[model samples]
Target: MKNLRDEFPLIAKNKFAYLDSSATSQQPKCVLKAVDDYYKKSHANPHRGTYCLSVEATNAYDFSRQKVADFLNAHFEEIVFTKNATEALNLVAFSYGSFLKKGDHVLLSLMEHHSMIVPWQRACKTHGATLDYIKLNNNFELDLDDFEKQLRKKPKIVGISSVSNVLGTKNNVKQIIEMAHSVGAKVLVDISQSIAHEKFDVEKMDADFVVFSGHKMYAPMGVGVLFAKEELLEAMPPFLLGGDMIEYVYEQETTFAPLPQKFEAGTQNVGGAVGLKTAINFLEEIGFDKIKEIETELTKYARAELKKLKFVECYFTSNAKNHENVISFNLKGIHPHDVASILDSKGVFVRAGNHCAQPLLRSLGLNSTCRLSLSLYNTKQDIDKLVEALKYAYEMFFKTK
Candidate 1:
């Protein structure tokens, strides 16, 4: 795979295997330069400014927004910028979720991150609504039959991930969305894990809401995109109340701004958005087809190698084609933290712990597991480092036995 490994300065300098891209990707130099240029050349508050610099800043910010909109094939006013996918999910939970009344149900899959689960839990509790989950099958993938049955609950809304952050299992979201909509439920799909590896056409996905983090896709942290239909953005109330989101402030009464600006309260991350645009540009230049080709090959290789280590029990599906981005497994009779620490000493990085999906871990009867999440930038050498580190960890823990 002809990857842009050298474009990332940190990746070039470090002798480290950064297998944690699902958490957040390393920023390319182009993306970093875009962010730097935004701050240095175009630094001002956007949307309400009249001065030259403010106008320039506003232009840059809007351009970034439009870039994202075009990428998603969404309306110009439909994309709202937030700090991260966490905030974007919270926005939907509080605002669009406000439509929920007593006895209504909210459904999500078992494999969602806390960012997706907790907000709906609280929202359901506050609104006197019911919350349910679509169970996972033996393969650790979402159970389609169970999901269809859950739709019998006639949920008001459903939140699901396009891909599980922990398991790397891709959901049949288009079919799931269809089922949810057949039962008159609005679907919100979190693509935070899959965004970097796969292509998305939100209009085609036919979901009411989509949330993703720019950092997870290759931009700097502090920028996320909330893609909703313009009508839905109009229907929902703003999540945060602050300066820039206002239309007019009266002593006793205030009016809010329209569509995108209404949800973006406080000072926006203009620099981060600029970085996001450049990051998207970088990926588009590579083409997602090639990105997926490289990652799938690497993941299959990692899985096959990990599988050979009989001392380790993989939490992944037996079908290597199913789980692509992440590989979660544990060394037999060793704490995941200990294994992760050993891998760290060898400059082989991977994540340990519940990965913010405590429910998913509990379902698997595991407190935690070491996770190797793949990105297009990752190499077979990175996989080799991880495999060798696992071998060392295994020997350290159970050599006497």
Candidate 2:
């Protein structure tokens, strides 16, 4: 397989050693040009006009929605586009929060991004429900035993991350879903970090909802997918009521559009969705399996090389069998921001701070962890640059002292 580095033109530019794919991925020319082409030639408001340009824009937008549905193995009607994963999650929280009662409970893990945790917390507060957090084991994997204990609590919604953005620990979502369902709790997966690395089948996972951002998959920012079971979407009320989501508005009563559009409200991110579809097509052409393999190799190389540094304390299981293509580690006697600054001086990019996963960071008893997240465009050579930068950083920070 020709790796993504060979396929993507941006890598050739040596713009920066980008290891922050967890933050957002570099867009391929195919996706970028798709957005440009849409604006340059076929720009118009979708579903609101009868002209040829409008029809073209509507078709392009609908095609992108269908592509996202197919990518998740979900029905097109179940997919709703939001500004980003945060908004996707907020929509669910706003709608479903109404269902909670005084004693109702919402379950989540410490590993979740704030996108997943904060919404539920606010929902619980508004709807009079309690929130429960699943603790991590010594290895930083969700402690199955702790999870089992929490299952007895039988929360109304069990929200979990498909992968930890900070630690790179992949969650056993299928097992978690099955377990949650057995307890009569619905599951919502925060898949922002996992969607690009592996397959996500909503039906197979039996999740009631799954939220993800487009940018993490090399799609444009400001577009995301919110997948809900059709019935759930139907049962939930409209998230935002406005012109498009309404069927008819009278002085007496108003009616709303069906499942997706009800939540979509105003004009959607038509161009972003088109770019997302193009990005998905690009990934499909490269084969997800190949991307996963390349990332796994890169992660393995990173873990092995980073472990050699005497000052480093690596997180995640060193086995590399269960981890994603990310590395989170701390250099002794140096703050993560300091380490990241030195690495940046070498043109190496990495993510620092809590990674919007404050609960997990608190659990680890640290203010922040330096993270290196890999993607298809990364190679072993990227890992080499990282290791070299780390050595220099360590010498400058620790050995000099």
Model 1, 1-401: lDDT tens digits are 33488888999888999999998899999999988888889899887778899999999999999999999999889999999999999999999989899999999999999999999999999999999999999998888899889899999998999989899998888998899999999999999998898888988988899999999999999999999988889989889998889999999988999878899889999999999999899999999998888888998898888889889899887766678789899988899999999999999989999999999999888999989898887899999988888888888877778
Top TM-score hit: 1
Per-residue lDDT value at 249 in model 1: 97
lDDT of 2 by residue, 171-238 (tens): 89999999999999989999999888888989888889999999999999999999999999999988
| lDDT scores in order | 0.91, 0.89
Q: What is the lDDT of residue 243 in candidate 2?
A: 78
Question: For all the candidates, what are their Cα RMSDs to the real structure?
Answer: 1.1, 1.2
List of clashing residue pairs for candidate 1: none
Residue 112 local lDDT, model 2: 90
Q: Of the candidates shown, which would achieve the greatest lDDT relative to the real structure? A: 1
Candidate 1 Cα misplacement greater than 4 A, ranges: 1-3
